[model samples]
Target: MPEIKRQHGKQLFLITNTKQNCAFYRKNKFQQFSHKIHLLNRQPLENWSFVRTLS
Candidate 1:
């Protein structure tokens, strides 16, 4: 992740469905960027987008 930040100097974006993992990222300073429902194989799933800015 640091490598990406060093290369881009932009906010990091992540998408995931695991609640536990998302909570972990939130605790570590990532902010909730978005929340949406995504369809996968004809079923709807809750997804979260997180962002971390590098200074």
Candidate 2:
């Protein structure tokens, strides 16, 4: 796990979805390093890998 940041209860928000965003990190892997992965407002889930969001 990443370095301990803020801890409240059993709930933990450590490094949300690092595996999803590649290149965002210097390293090629996600472990111990803490980071925030942005969620796509829109995504290409069908034939494309691009991210797209719908309102």
Candidate 3:
């Protein structure tokens, strides 16, 4: 049951993250996309792993 609950929570997180990403893209368009990617590449390994899961 705990494992199932954890999985559900992860699903919820992904859904919310996706929605936020959509809104961000709409607001920023493609102009900031490259900049964001550059920033992401420069992020530390730990932070990069978390960001990779979103994509």
Steric clashes per prediction:
0, 4, 0
lDDT for predicted candidate 2 compared with the true structure: 0.32
lDDT of 2 by residue, 7-28 (tens): 3232222332434453443243
What digit string (tens of lDDT, one per residue) describes model 1 on residues 1-55?
Answer: 7898779767787888888889898997899988899889989988899998877
- Candidate that scores best on TM-score: 1
- Candidate 3 — what's its lDDT? 0.31
- For candidate 2, report its TM-score: 0.17
Candidate 3 lDDT, 17-37, residue by residue in tens: 233465554453222222112
lDDT of each: 0.86, 0.32, 0.31
Cα-based TM-score, every candidate:
0.75, 0.17, 0.21
Per-residue lDDT, model 3, residue 42, is 70
Tell me, by lDDT, which candidate is best: 1
Better of 1 and 3 by lDDT: 1
lDDT of 1 at 52: 89
In model 3, residue pairs whose N, Cα or C atoms come closer than 3 Å (at least 3 residues apart or on different chains), thus clashing, are none
The TM-score of predicted model 1 comes to: 0.75
Output the lDDT of residue 31, model 1: 95
lDDT value, residue 39 of candidate 1: 89
Q: Higher lDDT: candidate 1 or 2?
A: 1
